[model samples]
Target: MTTLTLNAALHLDDFSLEVDEQIPLQAITALFGASGAGKTTLLRIVSGLHREAKARIALNGEVWQDSDNGIFVPPHLRSAGYIFQDIRLFSHLTVAGNLEFGRRRAAAGDGPALEDVIRIFDLKSLLQRAPDSLSGGELQRVSIARALLRNPTLLLMDEPLSALDARRKSEILPYIEKLPERFGLPVLYVTHNVDEVARLASRIVLLSQGRVIAHGDATEVLARTDLKPLADHLDPGAVLEATVIEHRGGMATLGVGTQRLRVPGISVESGIDVRIRIQARDVALAIQQPQGLSIRNVLDARILKIEHYGEILAEVLLDVGGQQLRSSITREAAEELHLQQDIAVYALIKSVAIDVGLAG
Candidate 1:
């Protein structure tokens, strides 16, 4: 498998970042962290834009930077397509003009046809419009199309959706999700939004205070509560990939591993795959499967571990049909139930607490 290898050290007056990692170039990999956590800086290093850092960066065996050998490849030569938070489309050019500029810069070989890009991004109607006349979501879609025109080997996105409001984000995410599989491209996406991470990223590199706290499969990394950076996030949760079994009576039954989950207000065709995000706080643990309850979803689970956060609360890790799930409860409740590792319990989740998105 192809991989991006990075061994970097960046030191500032108050903050220092040291990362040594080998990221697989299989699909979208998220660089997740809070502000001032060095996510953007690391992305710049990988793109060969931040040359001051002492680093050795390589992509799929090609060395982009080697500080010790005094070798450096400039950003343009790296062939990495970068997307910033702000839409940087030229106001003087029409959408088609902007796209043509990028297409003309393609290195060699046949690049993606303009018609194909326009169709993929649904941009046919907007081609004649100038950049200033487009909506935020439309502008972002155009920006992405322009990048694809370059026929880049890798894509780098620095919180591209941060500037968009909820509705605009929703409008543009589906388009972004299609890029990797549609073009066979590997993307290094940076974002702090866990929901975006759940839907878009297959792997995660969790950073905190300028260091990697955890890195692995998205499901495994998000299920962890031991990391303070992740735990502090508002919606710490477990991400599950499930296939739609059926939708009936205002509920959708999803097949996750061998277990089934019923979510409310979701209408999707049977056999479709979806990504589900269940917040840790929304999961309630019961000693046994309750007979009478308003909750519509329950799964047999085994306690993997329990982490106490001071004296107020505790986070419980669970194994549900071989997939990780997390529950956050009060410390007093945990002590009352005598919760511990290697114990069986029922995980109760309210149907309304789940967030569903298309599986990328």
Candidate 2:
């Protein structure tokens, strides 16, 4: 596995970022935290955009920054591609020109073919169109395509979708989703939005005050009781890959490992793989196997643990085929049901609760 080790200290006004973390080079490692939590600063440090009083940045085993050796690699030559929050496409350039600018700057033998990037980003119609003439989604697509043309070992994106409207964000999400599969390059994605983290990150680094508070799989990291404020609405009880069994009109039939689910309002081809999120709030407990309930999803789950965080809310940890899934309910509900570890129960969910993993 490619690994990144950073030991740095930076002073920003009254607060400081004294970070020391070893981040694995996975498909996408998200730097997630609340605002002023040093998410952006850490990205800057990695990109060599922000310097530190004492810095050591290395990938795999190569030294990028070391204080004692005075080894500091500048940002321009890091073999890294960066997508700024602004989608900084040059006004003078057309969509095609903006996409090819990176190739023009690369070593003669290493640059991607001009046509390859066009196909990757679906830039056919926009090739001759100017940047001002493109929609927000089109512009971001061009920006990401331009960065990929650099042949970067790693890609850095700083909330690239934050500037767009909901519709635009949806338009650009699939492109971002394809990055890990298409390029085989690790992406250091920075975002304060938790839903984005859930949909995109293969691995996650939870930062608080420039320190790595939590680092693990995306679902586990987001469910931490400590970070609940940021993950309130992103409470996907479980995430599982499913096969699209059939597609008729605007709906889809999905098979999640052992269970079958019917989802609404989606455009998916048959036999394709899709990711599903079972929201914690959407799951209801049953003493026996449910037969005639209006709910469609009923998994035979075992209670693993229980955690109460507030006067009204309590979270139950359930095990579904050795994979942990979360369920949220009132404290009174837990008591009324006499919930405890090792108790066998059924998890009920409706078809409407299922959502496509494309939200910003």
Candidate 3:
């Protein structure tokens, strides 16, 4: 398996950052944390922009830095494409010119052809347009195209969508989701947005106070109550991978394991796999399957574990046809329903609660 290892420590004026971990290079690995948590600092360290005295950084056996060995490869020498929050396109250059500049700096036979990247990013029409004339979303597309033209082995994105408004973010997210599959490149994405992590991240690294608090599959990491304080503001949720089976009567049918779910209308065609996010609070548990109800989705599930967040709220983990589903409810409700491990129950999800915007 491809991996990136970093063992480093840095002391700032008010805080110290220490990172010692081996990150598996998946299609997209999210570096998630709030402000001042060293998310950007870690990205800088990986890109060789920042250095630590005892740092040792390596990617797939290639040593980029080793303080003990007296070896340090500069930022430009590393095959990494760094995209900042700001769209750093050259204002004086046309879109094509910027892309050409990246192609020129690429290592010999490193990445895709310029024309291919342009096509993938749908930048053909914007070739002659100047950066200043492009919209925020369009500028981001151009910047990403330029990075691809550079033939980077590892792509580092530091809150690439944070600068854009909601509409612009929605416009660029589909493109970002395609990067890993289109180029087979490993990406380290830094973001505080839980929705983005749910949509794009295959693996996640949770950071707090410059330390890695959790790292694992995106679903598992999000479900842990230990990270509740970190993500409570976002209304922590679970991500489910499902396939679109059919669409009719303004509703889309999705297959999750052996069970079927009806959700709000989705634009994608049938047979396309999608990732769905359901907030824990949006799910409700039932002791017996209901007969008449407005709710459309009711899946049979068995209780796996129950965790009390505080005196009033609790998070229940349920096994739904072999897939995990989380439901957050009042402690009184859980006790009234006699919720316990190995007990069978039903999960009721409202169709509107399913966030289709985060689907990918």
Candidate 4:
């Protein structure tokens, strides 16, 4: 497997970034953290736009920067396609003209041809339009298409959706989700939104205060209670890999490991793979499986661990058919139910509480 290695130390007036990590080059690797966590700064270092003393950056054995050896490749020299928060298309030119500019700067490597780039990004209809006439989602799509036209070895995106509203963000996510498979390039995406990370990232390099606090599979990293304080502002949830079993009565049955979950509003056809996010706050635990309830989803689970956060809340980790599930409950409920590690329980979930998306 290919990997990107970064070892660097940078100090600013009030913030400093120190990271030493080897991230796998597959799908999307999210550099996730709150603002000022040096996510963009780290991305810049990798893009050869920012340099640190004695910093070392390499991708799949190709060294981009090694400060000690006086080896540093310029941003333009390195095959990195960068898409910033602002869609930096040339306002003076039509969308086709802007894309042609990217095609002109193409590297000698095996990059996508102009026609293939247009097809991949679904930009054929918008090619003749002006940048200002496009919507936020459309602009980003064109931006991504222009970036891919350069045929970079990897892609760097710094909060590409941060500026868009919820609707536009949703409008463009499906396209971004298909980048790695569609373009055959590794993407280092930086975002603070856990939802984006959960939806798009296969590997997560979680940063905090300019340091890497955790790095691994997206499901494992996001379910960790230890990272709660950093992500407390975001929703706490467990990401499960499930397969569509069948559709019946407007709901879809998804198989999570050996268990089954029935969710509503799943439009995908049966037999497709999907990722579902179950928020801890939406899960309720029962000592026994309850009957005659309106809830349609319940799974056999065993308590893996319990952690108390703040004063009134507790986060319980559970083993449900070999996959992890989390529940956030009041401390009073934990004491009342006598919940403890290794105890058998039932996990109740509402069909509407589940967030479903296509898995990469």
Candidate 5:
């Protein structure tokens, strides 16, 4: 069992972060929560910047903090790369010079090849240009490249893209996606944006008020009804992969489990398997086939389960061609409609509710 044992107790005068739990830190672990939820605080402790009262933090086998045993690895020697919200690039240095700083500071002969990282991040053009001369996206790329050059065992990113605009975020997303593929290392990404977590996180850690409320697969924890209070105030949805068939006019045809769903606002080419998220509230169930509706996407499904959700609401679970879907409805509606498990029904959904995020 690959687990990160984190049993820490700290006090920041009037505020304390007391957490005792083990997080599976093998892949990208997303620290998700609202503001003042201690996500950044935990990151600070993990990076060895914040000292704890009684710390017993260990990653794999290396001892990061074990105050009882008199072992506490300092931040400098931790070999953990940290990327703050601001890129924090030195205005005096050029892109090439900034990236080389990590290589120079890295333990003797421990960093990755300098040439490869430069090419991988497409920093050749900005090599001679100073930090002040580069755009936001270019500076972020330079930030990431510098971290990679350090060849750290784990990379820590604290809302790295939060400071960038939409265009700039979109510009740097591809580089972020390729980092895992290129390095094959663990990353600790802290963010409040669900869209970023949906796109990148393999295992998500739900943090609330200086503690880990829940930690598991990105999809499972995000889909949980109980996590609604902790997660961002947004409708729950399931992430699915679909192959784009063709593009016609403003809509794109995609294949999803024995049916073709025409999605709107998709700007991708054919043969690409795009990831989609369909909200539960948008999905409606019917006892019998009731045609003649404005809704376009309809699927045959079997009732899987039903659970109580928000006030005056019940979430209906349906199995659609091996894919699970949830529909939020009123308690009175459920009892009146006599919704039961294994019952065949038709699930109606609109194309606009199908969100095109999280590329599978």
Candidate 6:
């Protein structure tokens, strides 16, 4: 399998950024951290925008930067497409002109055709319009289309949705989600939003104070109780891939690994796959399958592990038909219910607690 390796150290004023790890190039890896966590700096280093004394970076066995070997590739020669948060489109150029510039800069026989990129991003209609006249979402789409036209091997996106409103963010997210599939390119996405990480990333690299805290599968990283403090006020949860089985009467039925979940108010059509994030706090535990309950989702689960958070709350990991589900409850309730590893319990989840808009 192809991989991207990084081992570098940089000292700037009082802050130091040190990264030593290997990332798989097969999936979209999210470089996630809070502001000032050096997420963007790492991307810049990989793109050859930042240079350090002992830096070394290799992608798919090809060396881009090797300080010992006295090799350093410039940013423009690194074959990376970088999209900034501001959607940096040339104000003087029309959409078509900007795209042509990207195509002209590509290496011989590299990247996709201009017409294919336009059709994929739905940018054909905006070809003649200036960048200044486009909306935030439209500009972002154009920016991404231009990047694809460059035919880069790797794509770097730095908070591409941060400048847009909720509506605009929603509009551009679908395009971002399809980029990896529509074009075979490894993406290194930098963002502080856990929702975005959960929705789009296959792997995650968690950074804190210019250091790597954890890096692994997106679902596994989010379920870690030890890293909860760095999660930016978002509840730790599990992400499950499910298919919409049916939708009727404002409810959507989802099939997840032999279990069924009924979520309220999902607008997706049946048979389409969607990702659902279920926060641990939204789930409650029951000793027995209760009767006459208002909660619509109660699945038979087996306790996998228990970890205490602070003094009062405990996070319980459960296995629901091979899929991991988490629930956070008070220690008192956990003890009263006799929760332990391998014990069977019922997980109660309210349908309304699920926000369908976050599903992608």
Kindly report which residue pairs in candidate 2 clash with one another.
none
Better of 2 and 3 by TM-score: 3
- Estimate the TM-score for candidate 6: 0.68
lDDT of each: 0.85, 0.78, 0.85, 0.85, 0.78, 0.83
Model 3, 148-213: lDDT tens digits are 889888999999999999999989998999898999889999999887887799999998888899
Model 3: runs farther than 4 Å from truth? 52-54, 236-360
* Candidate 2 positional error at 268, Å: 46
lDDT at residue 157 of model 5 (Cα atoms): 87
Better-scoring candidate (TM-score), 1 or 5: 1
Off by over 4 Å in 6: 235-360
lDDT of 2 by residue, 181-244 (tens): 7777789999888768867898888877667778888877754544443444454445555677
Against the true structure, candidate 1 has what lDDT?
Answer: 0.85
TM-score of every candidate: 0.69, 0.66, 0.69, 0.68, 0.66, 0.68
In candidate 4, the residue pairs with backbone N, CA or C atoms under 3 Å apart (3 or more residues apart, or in different chains) clash, namely none
lDDT for each residue of candidate 1 in 38-156, tens digit (9 for 90 to 100):
99999999998899999999988899999999989998888788898897998899999999988989857677898999999999999999999999999999999999999988899
Clashing pairs in 6: 111-151
> Which pairs in model 1 have colliding backbones?
none
C-alpha displacement of 85 in model 6, angstroms? Answer: 1.3
lDDT (10s digit) by residue, model 4, range 19-127 = 9998887999999998888899999999988865457999898999988889999999988999989989999999999999888999897778888888877889998
TM-score of candidate 2 relative to the true fold: 0.66
RMSD of each: 15.6, 16.1, 15.6, 15.4, 15.8, 15.6
- lDDT measured at residue 93 in model 1 versus the true structure, 0 to 100: 94
Better of 4 and 5 by TM-score: 4
